[model samples]
Target: MPSHRAASLLLALSPCLIAQTPASPAPLDGIWLGTLHTGGPSLRIQIHLHQDAAGKWTCSLDSLDQNGVGIPCTLSSATNPIAIDIPAVHAKWSGSLTANTLDGTFTQGADMPLTLERQSTMTKPTPPATPDAALPPADATTIRAILDKDLAAALSSGALAPSTNAGVTIGVLAHGKRTIFTYGTAKPDSVFEIGSISKTFTGLLLAQMVEQKSVQLNEPVRDLLPPGTVAKPASGSEITLLDLSDQHSGLPRMPDNFAPADTTNPYADYDSKLLYADIAHHGVSIAPGAPFGYSNLGVGLLGSALANRANLPYNDLLHQQITGPLNMTDTSVVLSPSMRSRLIQGHDAAHNSARPWDLDALAGAGGIRSTAADMLTYLEAQLHPNQLPATAASTPQGKTLPAAILASHTIHADVPPGMHIALNWFRADATGNFWHNGATGGYSSFALFNPDKDFAFIVLFNTTISDKSFADRLGQHIAQRLAGDPAVSLAN
Candidate 1:
């Protein structure tokens, strides 16, 4: 849907300082390290300062407590009573610089007193560097070599060579053992855009919200929109949240107002204003639930409606509802510096470097970036939905893991004799397999698992293969190899 863009991480901040700092005289010009003693846990704080050749001063904040690094900010008044503005997170810090320490207050929604003392050394840990080479870990399974040969065949076919010069990571989960393989310039932790797999997450979010009774799946779309907003079809039939999740809402693949600043990285500039404007001016292309027509706009609107109902951003709702409980820490709409560092560069099928897509308003359609390791963990949770916490300790976003998982995977529409569509998932009723595939401008990913066979596989490639069917076939092959059932394999 769009290209991937690197993002700065937003660290969670609490307003309290209960720790003492060791005093130093190292000229706040290097790195200042301190601990923010808040009511909860201690947070590691790092402040950096530098002077360019022009003698212009610059500084940044790193809150290790929240895993944020290099938060951009503007400095005010270099002398006494220094002001540091971090508008990205709506935070600001003001303190007076002394010979070796600075004492001031940090304000982010609230104010907390803080003291920073220069560190003895500038050895703060940087984000992990890219892997030196692409090699599977020593414990790789036989599938690595097999998958390599398969990939080589795809490359030889001239299908992948036209627009791909990227890496791939594959995993085969068979008999309770996971064997991971890497090709090109990828590592186990390398991240790729999962594209429409994000819709599966949105589907899960819908299930969680419905289970919590915060949202009614069968309610009218007009009821969820802001008061007086128009979102109606020509048939006069009401669209429901279920319609959106089921891909029967009759919405287009994308909003008509989508005029991207960069076509290569399209969704980056589309915001809520544009999304709403498009919705307000648009009419349904078809009657609701008349047929199975896949619509990214429908799912994106579903996610937006859920966020509106919960009074939270799509990303936050996602964290509280699904990712947090499943411990899919690396899956997120926003990339932390560490996650960004681990991201693999995507390539077109032509083997040219491509820009990454960034989402502004429609993250639910395709805005998630994740790693093979994290995705497998998610698949594991899906396999054992009961393992999800009955209820989130901090939020009312759990307790329906079983029902949600079941509801999401249940067939809602039949695509054909072999394929059936569920809540953002395609189920192979013939083979008892549940899966989904995703692609973006520069990446293609396949995630599939058969619970009955106790098998699953995730294959992520940082190249625009332009053939999701090819990727799906690769995934089916892995699933069959693991399940020892060639009968389940799809014809190539």
Candidate 2:
């Protein structure tokens, strides 16, 4: 893999004028006052912003004290709100400007309960300034402390079912111009199950092949699949590769003939022979490019189609075309013993014991494993889609994949109030945030980045940590700290 200058978070746009920022911003320019509503109760949080003469914003947070003396806090992302994530603490936060309030949520870290709050104009009198020097400034340690709290909670919360005697592993990288703050196990070469993250890789590689003329997105799959290969769309003899990738093929989420020999490692038993045979027998139910339905089968079919045209095994094709070029050594469909050793044991429950489940049959769907380090590179490539080695932001193929990658980030469809699913990647909770996440039996993961803002983030947990309460509160905390301004947090 060639060296890629990893991508950064989306560049900050002046905080949006959802409602104009207070015209005569008070101490508000520096000190942020808000109440956190965790449902069980509310806690007061005070944040003091320090700006050098240059007008850049850096924040210091303190949960309100008994005497109201602002104690220093360790909220993550004070500099880049949209890129909020801290693995050591096992939490993420984000904020948005609402009609009148900065509505946000903060997910609990490893062991904490999540909080949700709306921080807006406060009438409370400002406390007399103590020597700002009394408090040590925020840095990686502070962020890690906050995240560590969450990590402990996540570990206890069944994120690690003993079925696998493994510790949960998490990786986080803060993309600042001066340095990248990375935190994880010292075993630098570990491989993690990035799971559905493979979908993003597949999307990008398909864009690459499209660039190389090795695969055409518009050509019907029938043109490539062996003759008589039966797909659901009997009426339309052709379903384009884009159809499969974009989830427009009208293909069922799981093929009718997809029963595998090993249910645990579902895809492991379905090799090319099985994939080809299945397509030939099982039929389609809808026309190509029809309604939107998420289909893992669609992803696998696309991968198989690409491999056939490229004449390389699917894993090797990924290496030669994407991971290898980006130097993602720890990312692959298959893991070596050395790399595997670093893997935190995957547990099936928050704090219970569980076994590892296999999905070899779903190779193209969610079979790839990776570490946070490798994902940072992938995250970077996404923000600067135009800066890629050979893919354009708008054009389908060529040097630099900006155009092609950008197409994947478009708001394809709405999933929730602040979420949408586009191609393989989806926008997470933040209004302007675009991201994707995945889960294996013992893992829960997240990757988010905004190209327009030049910012990015990735978070992976060993267990399912998607309970709305925890994630909501944690996300809120990170948002206030970062403030959705990438340049402030990451500006060199």
Candidate 3:
């Protein structure tokens, strides 16, 4: 590369160059201080700014929590305003920079959009320099301490519950293996109920059967029901697994058959008889593949129908096919003696005793239990569908189950807002983040993994809510935080 003429000339004419240098540099190019407000989470930062002769410029931000750690990014349009993208965190900062104020929107993750303003003492940013990678040595320690302190603060302030608060655990997987950075429960082996997260299991099973030509995605669900099943509706025959997986089966979030006298543990009272009766009278509220209405009934009915195909009980098939092969020793519909001992106690907001739950009628929908360790392993399989252990151990000229699981976990239908539904997993656009969340009687759990980044995380707690809004908010918050959007402060 040729040296810049201006650079060479400047060295030859140092005195003249100094004679023309601007006495006062542009106000925008300096070491400036600011705050990143993510609504629920906020961070203080130091930003470095730089400009080129051609007007091209770059901006970097370093977080105080990260102890002035900086990351490089292109500054979009700086002529009349300013913009910044922290790719590492997927945070896009944009705003108008006037003589006195800087106003713009900062987007972190999926929880909610945040509007940020300059702190009262903010100053112009300094010339850009090579940004730091990790938090400062002492600040790294401080980050951990701050996390605990903030967590406590949130709890005391009612944003988080003491014992039953839902929290996230980050895990890393490498070379077909996994390691947990931090697990909530004292023991790394403890299991938490995986609630609707179990839907992926049913979906995987359905996809597996479909891959084998045993079941068709578009085939009517009616074909898979047990013989002598009841009926009282005209559109029941139109429902299909595809519809269920896509959340467009015209089914309600749950079934009317779920007459839970006790709202605390809703699914506990729903029986198999009621499930069968309801399906028999299934009158789809809308046309298949229409609007998306998240329905637990759709997945529940799908699981029941899948069990029917193999003439095996849902739990038996669940274990025999997926859990057994994966060696998920602790995941099961029924808790064993050893598992019961390892079970973490569920608690409410007051840290009071919470009831155990059984999703009998919809076991396939929300009746699985797993540890953070096992979930990492499961996520790994999804991330690396081709390199599954089953594939390596496959017998030549014989069938291998791994291929079926891969096909099952791939996107099957589109949901909304850059999301798509795979068999039992959720696809976060093309990011290759496949995930599912589970909530039992009193416990709520979230699991997500990105195939591209080799990153996976889980958030499990002993508190749950029947309120859909709360659950969605909690899930999105955990997801945003783990996906490197540090703007997500608390799990609350």
Candidate 4:
């Protein structure tokens, strides 16, 4: 006879015991798609399962909306109550399998209900390779020899993808002169994803819309959404567009349902549905307009809201408002066929090939890909606002660039002593310098400029290893030297 507590424990153990009864092997090898519903967003998830001749089970997870794929995983037990584990992202799924379907819950830090249905058709991905169009070695005279040595050492230090010839492209604009430097596999035209920097564009879009009076920065964000789409959080303070742009919207770094089916292409399948679902479910954790808290969701939501106001997609509004007028042909949410040919392969810190990211609903958070030349042209516009076409200061459409630029560069939040938030731009309160950094699974980018000194530099890399900081060092070194203050340590 068992005591009551012991009986309760046995009752709980009965499920696992029953589940362990090795029912027939469920023939789990196939493509399975599912949706994960959470308090924040609903993520679209996929899994690829296969069995080796040796009878070992292997699985790959994909978060369709997250632009992630082929996330390595292992399958436990071939029958009902199967468990799938992905250690790379510290995520797991446990559920009962019935016929060709799996009903389970996925957990990372939190839990979400998921249902997976098998599909007959799924294609394999191509192996990554360096672009054949890579240009011959170009002069790197503009790059400091010390910085170049550091770049070389960092790439060889086993911090980046092994055997992959990774490198960086440097572009500098200073004192009425421009210089371009290419190293490793990079060229002036090599394209790399410019991750979170896309937020700056979203901020600019906000400013433009505000100037047009189509949206108000300080107004409640619910005004832009379809009525009843988003449930305001208990926080009495309404989140404003300005709060979204300034990184203070109180949204989490990622939504609860941001579980990736494929970690490589993390944002591919996230749609507007997920965005709204997440917002309605979670609302803000802190007060809507609380202190600084960096959030991809905040900026992403801002982009969606702005797009709604303009009756356009985020990409289209970005083009009509900024990229088109700036003649930034190479900057876009999607690469053109020509750009694809020039796209450099990206690698992770472990020397493994990393799949490029694709943002569907979250494109505004970090979706644009660009080249060094194009970024330099962009920096030129930022460095010398007067050089832009007279109309560039004011979009013939409702956007007003002058006002937007001023608004973007104005300090909106106090960060650490040296830094502050200005719209989407990170400003150096001490020096009035503007800079931003972006990273994806396999790439990183840095841009810094001082309008008064007419100096700026852009560093783009094809690897997101710890060594990627070489770009920051190089950029800071160049900016400082160009400012005639080479003694300033980047570490400072």
Off by over 4 Å in 4: 1-162, 232-235, 284-289, 390-399, 465-468, 484-492
The model with the greatest TM-score is 4
Candidate 1 residues lying further than 4 Å off, grouped into runs, are: 1-142, 148-164, 231-235, 284-289, 389-395, 467-470, 485-492
Better of 2 and 3 by TM-score: 3
Better of 3 and 4 by lDDT: 4
What TM-score do all the candidates reach, one by one? 0.66, 0.59, 0.63, 0.67
The lDDT-based order of candidates, best leading, equals 4, 1, 3, 2
lDDT of 3 by residue, 18-103 (tens): 11222322356555554544323344455567676865455656554433344444454464445554432324556555443444
Q: On a 0 to 1 TM-score scale, where does candidate 2 land against the true structure?
A: 0.59
lDDT of 1: 0.66
The local distance difference test score of each candidate is 0.66, 0.50, 0.56, 0.67
Model 4 accuracy (lDDT, Cα): 0.67
lDDT digits (tens) for residues 1-492 of candidate 4: 000000000000001111233244467888988765432334456789998897656676765543345655566446666777643333467888776678776653234466778888764432222212222222234445544543454456432224666767888777667777777778888999888778888988888788778888787788887779877666567788988888767665566587668766778888889988898887643453264556778889999989888899888998888887777888998888988988888866444578888898889988899988788877776676557655564657423665666667777886433467888887776666788777777777778878876677788988762321444445545555554443213221
Ranking by TM-score: 4, 1, 3, 2
Model 2 worst lDDT window (10 residues) = 1-10
Candidate 3 has which clashing residue pairs, if any? 30-125, 30-126, 31-125, 31-126, 32-125, 200-424, 231-280
